[model samples]
Target: MTERKVIWNGRVQSDMVDYNGHMNDASYSLVFSESLDALMETTGLDASGRERHAYTIFTLEAHIRYLQEAHEQQALRTTVTILDQDAKRMHLWFEMENEDGDTIATSEQMVMGMSTTTGRPGPFPEEVEQSLSPLPKLDREHWPTHANVQMGIRRK
Candidate 1:
């Protein structure tokens, strides 16, 4: 895989800030999730499409590190890489950068494919996999290491 960029832009809202005046931890997850959604859209697989295919993605693991604060009104950008993929899993890396290109946060996500109705793990469909197989590989050195704590936002 080659290096490629998937852009996700964010407009910091007042509600996203905490007492410290920066984006709250939960807000960060929201931005990251939205970015992932946009990235998947590029492959013609949005939330609804996943259901239509009877294949959905669930985040199995994630490592995220915050390097800088994003205040209200700041414009944030995100770049994503495919990292790795097999029969039923995928590893992806997402980098959040400020308007100046400064790294604000990074997240490495491990996702698994599952049958929507059956709720059983399964491999990605050939067409879906083919559409997403062109993403770039992750650079080990670039994987975020500062975040050692485990965190996640489960879909309800």
Candidate 2:
């Protein structure tokens, strides 16, 4: 398995804290969303690339699990793993860790390439696909246990 690369880094701001005195539920999603942008930039989907190819990536779905609390001023880092991808869509897993290296949250997302002109799903441009080739790709068997979870009320 290739080592996952840190894609984004940030510190929890005072505004991100809730009455509980830690990052709020929505804040976790916000950080993960920012991490996605960083991933897009690395894959040649940045503003100029999107304009040049008339293409962009859109988040189709996202599931985030909060494992620990993040406090204000705590340093945070995020890494992404490409679980799978096709011509038009990608299954990605993002992990956010606190300064102590404890995973505070994880987000599994499905994103797709879209044609900005037509506002429809489309295959990624060749250059963008090529750029994504170097990123970490992990097989299903190697995925973390928390990944691919189905959310619902459980009863036995």
Q: Which candidate is the best by lDDT?
A: 2
TM-score: model 2 vs. ground truth = 0.96
The estimated TM-scores of all candidates read 0.83, 0.96
Model 1: CA > 4 A from native: 139-156
Positional deviation of residue 45's Cα in model 2 after best superposition, in angstroms: 1.3
Flag clash pairs in model 1: none
Tens-digit per-residue lDDT, 34-57, candidate 2: 999999898888899899999998
lDDT to native, each model: 0.79, 0.92
TM-score of 1: 0.83
In the range 15-80, model 1's lDDT, one tens digit per residue, is 999999999998889888888778767765786778678877788888778889999999998888
Residue pairs whose backbone atoms clash in candidate 2: none
